[model samples]
Target: MSNQKDHHYIPQFLLRQWTGEDGRLVRFYKPHATKLMAEWVYPSQVGFEKHLYSTRNPSRRGRNWLENDFLQRVDSMAARSHAKMVQSPVVGLSDAEMSAWSIFVRTLFHRSPSGFKSTQFHSIRIWEETVREIGPRYAQMKGPDDPETIDEYIREGINGAAYDQVLEHFPDTMMSSRVGQFLNNLHHAYLR
Candidate 1:
């Protein structure tokens, strides 16, 4: 999956930026702090889903009309991306896997205008960590020679009872609220 070469809403270079030197996904990618995203991060190249839900700098008043108009279209693509946020775009754990994780979880991490309980937030945080970190950690356990071990570990993390137990800690309200319902619907359509 890592080598599939698919389109990305959040650029892989950017995502790799967030990875810790030890290969964990830290909150920020600190290694290349001075890199400028000007030529690299282009909103026009992103898909509608990413444009709508994941775009970070939507209203910067671009240098030209075309850029500005494109940004507006990106904003109007809100049917997919509605969290008009700048600065920190994606944060923490997410329902999404691989490339989709950061985009899907941005709203949960911020954007809702209301906050979540520490327990609920922790459940969310831990769940994503469990899904993401399990494979690499598993390699450390079983030795790094088995690439299949990563897949097995990920499957275990997803289908395992331990994963289910962590989810059980997530607030029911977090799953039942309006925002939760919206996420559920979105999941059924795109993720499930």
Candidate 2:
């Protein structure tokens, strides 16, 4: 559950499940709401941290071990949040807040020497742009005139089937490069 108490901050799409797929979940909501979620979470920082840890070259059993463990935990948390976003969409942040997060993440990635992690920025950015273009109604059913329960908004977007829509709508080289960098451990970020 989100801590946002203001009703005005909650988007209607977060009230229900939208789409689904096997192995992965799908959530739908208005484009604006999706944009908010995509940019608002600051997913890029996770990538930046990952890149930093990978470059550290930790000793067999030294502080590097602890650092690596911490980075893994952060990565896990980021992955969980992304999965939840697809499994259960919740909109409680305003567009401005989300944009600020994106900007911050972008700045962090840009400045980090381990900019390899910033590769994920393209995927998040594309998702945010798509959400802005899709419109809320196009993604999920409209919520009630007055939302008493925020859970409903979260529930409405969790669809297990619409996962393909993401790939269909947001196929980008940057996403591929990020994935490649994660798998190969080398940074060739010319796509950005």
| Candidate 1: stretches off by over 4 Å | 1-31, 40-107, 110-121, 124-159, 165-172, 177-192
Question: Among these predicted structures, which one has the highest lDDT?
Answer: 1
lDDT of 2 at 40: 24
TM-score of each: 0.21, 0.21
Put down candidate 2 lDDT per residue, 1-192, tens digits, no spaces: 122111111112222223233222233335774463332222221222322322222244432332233323333343333343454344333333333233323333433433432443454455445544545454354445522333333333222112222223222322344543453443322111
* Candidate 1 residue pairs in clash (backbone atoms < 3 Å): 17-29, 52-81, 53-81
Write candidate 1's Cα lDDT for 1-192 as tens digits.
211222233433334434555544523223577953432323323321311222122223322222123223332343223222222544223343211333235323422213323433465456656557765566567755543576665455444433344334333332335654465455332221
The 0-to-1 C-alpha lDDT of every candidate, in the order given, reads: 0.36, 0.32
